[model samples]
Target: MDLLDDESSAGASNAPEFSVSELSGAIKRTLEGAFGRVRVRGEVGRVMKAKSGHMYYDIKDDRNVIACTTWKGQVSGLGVLPEEGLEVIVTGKLSSFSAQSRYNINVDTIEVAGAGALMAMLEKRKAQLAADGLFAPERKQALPFLPEVIGVVTSPSGAVIRDILHRLRDRFPRKVLIWPVAVQGANCAPEVTAAIAGFNQFTPGGALPRPDLLIVARGGGSIEDLWGFNEESVVRAAAASDIPLISAVGHETDTTLIDFASDKRAPTPTAAAEMAVPVRLDLMAWVDGQEARLSRALAQGIGQRQQHLRDLSRALPRPETLLNTAAQRLDLWADRLPNALRAGIQSRQVRLAQAGLRANMLRNLLTTGQERLTTLDRRRPAALTRQVNTARRHLTATTGRLRLSLLQQDVARKSEAYGQLSRRFTDLARAQLQGRRNRLDTLDRLRETLGYQATLARGYAVVRAGDQVITTKAAAAKAGSLEIEFQDGRLTPQMEAKAAKSRKKPDTPPPDQGTLF
Candidate 1:
């Protein structure tokens, strides 16, 4: 109740008052005006992408944190997308949302804070990928000794690709397929990944042959400039590639995550080319050397075989000596041939005389044969009659089995079944034909209902110029001669003119002309 208290209360009452919305707005404006644009270096936390494609995340330090947002349109242009626990430098304008009563940054670009941050992220990613066995030696494929087609993924404008080509040409000329891509940008990872997958999609014997070896090459650059190769997407793609891949991302001193994932790693782009093919001169020299060795071995083998043949021949007896005994035996046999023949003839003559084989013995044999013939002739008629009786019985039995009535019955049964089947077939064919006719009629009706002629029946006339119908007034105006079609018939320009003439009243002859005035 003091006078000073009253003065203080009255002063407080005179102070300005604001609604919730106005106060929030005023604060937002002040905050935005104070920090229009800024670059904040902090560790990203709780990274998220909205369904609307805007990225939402928090950038925090030990003391405080700030909410950050990257609109969908600007996300792609960012050098790197923010991940949780990643320290990044964010560049953006400050913004405040009155509804949320909080200030946040509308991020324009985001990148790793420095090489240390990048290395830390790279190490984390490397550990994760290594745990997944992407760097396992057993998963790697051996490169082809000489690939028919070599696919290169690099920027076409860069000197790296030119160096690779030049090196390849100098070593051994090969068919090179260039899949041009951005080597160092936000687009680099996606484009290079897609190139690897696209090369794998080619059919082996297709018009564009599949590459036997893949070489992903890029020139030397700083860690940040070569970060696209370190991207998770690029590393994953390299590890998953079915084709043998050689990563030549940076100089020997500059290592990237892709080097560990690739099937082989080259220190430089030129080194990658060297790994892809062997020197032609060296290959030719090796081939010549192998040919010479093979020829010498062949000559040595032939000489050894000839020497063995001569040794074997020395152990064998001479042909004349081996045949000497056989010749002597042959001569002895030939000398005794005439005497043996004469002795055999004399012994055969003596045996013939002792046996008494003469004309009387022949007559006795003839008499015995005549007696045997007489006995056989006596039994012939009886055998012939018995055989005839057997043949007759067989014929009678066979004739009895062939009854005409049975054959007629079988024929009638078959004929009835055939007629039934034929009738059924005829009925089925007629039904199918009727169904087809009904379908055809329905289609014809549908065609008529949908056709423009049906529209003409409803008081609409179609104006045609030649065979084409004119639907618009502009088209009708352009038509030199109109053919108007109604449901009844078409009225051509000539027909219309004739009808107008017929409808016109006969021109009244000029009175002066008719009256001869």
Candidate 2:
């Protein structure tokens, strides 16, 4: 039994306590000297990365964040940046940093416990920038619709590059130049600031003109991944640059102080890409519509010209109508002239015939008048003498009757004168009777002396031709026969003229006076 007890004691003394490296490491990870699985809420300060690819930062809450380190490979997939005043929950073993020999948490798995913690620090920074008027709307830039050059501050090799390319290809398809920049991590702010400045300087003399728009973009991640855009220097560079900027640094749900400072904000890199370019199909449709309108205008102009020509045609004059009217007038004149001339000739001929008949009648009447005047001259004086003698006889009878009546008015004168008057009257009557008988006998003798038939009976001759007496001696002597007139019978005489030497002369008779009554 004493030997069993001795074996138990000896085995217990041989048992392993711990290796010194393990002992010190375990001792370093404890409740008293270690900060174990505790949640720290603070703002980050002095954020850094070592050459071995480890990230170190302090966790602060308005004042501090204890020092901590994450191995390069472990934090390689963080897809975010660690920065000052970042709040997180760290699960790790506490250990000494050899350079300062100071104890700190070697971070294992870390999580962002209070995102508002970081926001509180960012809000304070935002207020400071606002008080300085750095984030004022007036301080912001304006974006260009058609940019000749585009500067991008984002991960060098990321999906953001492809997104912008796809958008440019579909929209503008113009020449573009890209400048690579860091999108996240400790060096992101300075690197982005440098890239913006370098692009500005190089833009003046480069193949591409200076950027009209600057697009800061990155793939989606935690808020820390997009924090580079929040840095004051990066923001001021974006604002101060001559170019306009588009902030597309995070997912649709994320927002930052840089968004207010930019000229425009996009939900994501893809959204930024879409905003930069236009669609090609819409331009083609507009060109086709313009062509159709031009074609319609040409058609309308042609129609107007055709109507004008039609109007002009109607207004033109017709020479044929004027000629036809003139011809009709000429034909009317041709039909009337000959008839008028023939009628005028017939009227003139009829007038000439009438005038000739009137002239012949006048000539015959003149010849008859001359013959009547000759007969009247031969007989008119003798008839007037007989009428005068009868008138004298009537006057003598009337005077005698008037005297006889006046004397009968006194009986004594009648008786006394009657005896005387009877004797005287008887004697006177007897004498008057004898005188009247003698006068009557004388008138009978004168008749016998002047009558042509009585002169033929008394052996007288009258030679006449065509009722005219022959009075000339030569006319009577050369005649073959002469008419002899007597008181009772007429005889034709043989008229012989004696020779000129045998002719005898006759004696002259005495003159007588007219008898008184």
Candidate 3:
């Protein structure tokens, strides 16, 4: 306590505080241990990367921000290069350096975060609404084919109101009333619901004119900021409305639950306006078109009637003498035949000459009948030919009987000889040959029983791998060809099956060898 304590106190008083380098090292170590791996999301700006394997950037929100740094090695594998003015989420070890007396995230991963989560949330909400029948085509009330008074629900001061108003004014400014709404933030749901209710209700003074169609709309924003239209109350209010609701919320790509529940969805406020009112010019054009079509139809009808009248006139007949006309036509044909025949007779004289020659030949033959018979009698050789034919027939009959008698005697001798030879033979040789034939037939039948082609015909199957027949369990040890044989042909199935290991046969004891024991 005397010398050493005094000296120690003096040293403590004189010694400088811990160096900045030491403090920084301690802080970095403490932070690394405290927040090993964390995820942070913020807007990115002023991204500066050092060649010494370090990256620096500012992580800002709407109100405040902080400088952030990530070692190059940690963020090298991130597919996207860090850029200014992109909202991103960074995951890394949290570290602090006492030397600089500052803390930064040592980013390990980085990506656009809100888009994926927002997409997922939107998809979930859409699915829920779809299941609830809010998105059913049946639930979507058809827009009054010609809505008279269109109602508008949007921000009173936003560009959306101006856009909707401008479009309505330019196109069909006949009479539209915009029911102002809080389209963003916590109060959005209640405000929109009330606006819709007010339109639907029977209210008195200060009430906006009743609208047959209500337009619910907004401009595009971040998913969170645009989430008010996706709220349950807003959707229910839209679905409950008797007045048809038209939703023009956000950009074309932006989807919300209210869009599904509403009667129709317009991509933007301007589109909603267009949908709510028919263009004056377009209506005028349509009226003209209808008028033209009516004119064309009337003309076609008149022309068709006139043509019908002309056809009837030509087909009609007066009460004149139809019978008299038919009688005259018949009498006119009766005197025409003889004249027709005379005009066709240029070769009749040659035909008459031939007829005369045929008549002369017949007369001459009749006059020489007896002379012709005498000449035939001189030509005849003898009448004994008939007798010769009779005697030859009798001789042939006698020879035939003799031949039949000889044939019987020969057959009797042959039968006796055959009986003697066969009595001395046995049936054993014939039976043995027949048994061998039966065995070969049995083997052929077995092959046909299990053959792949035969089995296919029999409505059975054989799964084969390559060229191998796969006759036994051992042959199909590997999966390969995968051919599926059918009745018509074989097909290689796109899918393959692993070869199953057949169960091993139980081992049998060695044959007994104790015969001499």
Q: Report the candidate with higher lDDT, 1 versus 2.
A: 1
lDDT of 3 by residue, 1-517 (tens): 5999999999999976877677677777877888788888887878887889688888788897767777656653552445676678877778775556777776767765567654554576677777887777887787876666777888889999888879888987845777787887656777888888878884423355567788998999977668778766788889888889999999999888898889999998889888887888999999999999999999999999999999998887764655788777878877776776676563554555554554455445533643554454444324334534554554556567677566555555655554454433324334544554555455455545545568688786676777655566665556655676778877665543222223445689899787765
lDDT of 3 at 313: 81
Which candidate leads the pack in lDDT?
1
TM for every model, in the order presented, reads 0.59, 0.39, 0.38
Clashes of 3: 4
Runs of candidate 1 with Cα error greater than 4 angstroms are: 1-27, 50-52, 318-517
Please tell me which predicted candidate would have the highest TM-score against the true structure: 1
**Positional deviation of residue 7's Cα in model 3 after best superposition, in angstroms:** 42
Residue 438 displacement in candidate 1 (angstroms): 92
Model 3: residues >4 Å from true position, as ranges? 1-125, 202-209, 317-517
Which lDDT value does model 1 have at 192? 91
For each candidate, what is the lDDT?
0.86, 0.68, 0.72
Please report, as a residue range, the 10-residue window in candidate 1 with the lowest summed lDDT: 354-363
Q: Which 10 successive residues of model 2 have the least lDDT summed?
A: 492-501
Better of 2 and 3 by TM-score: 2
**Which model, 1 or 3, shows the larger lDDT?**
1
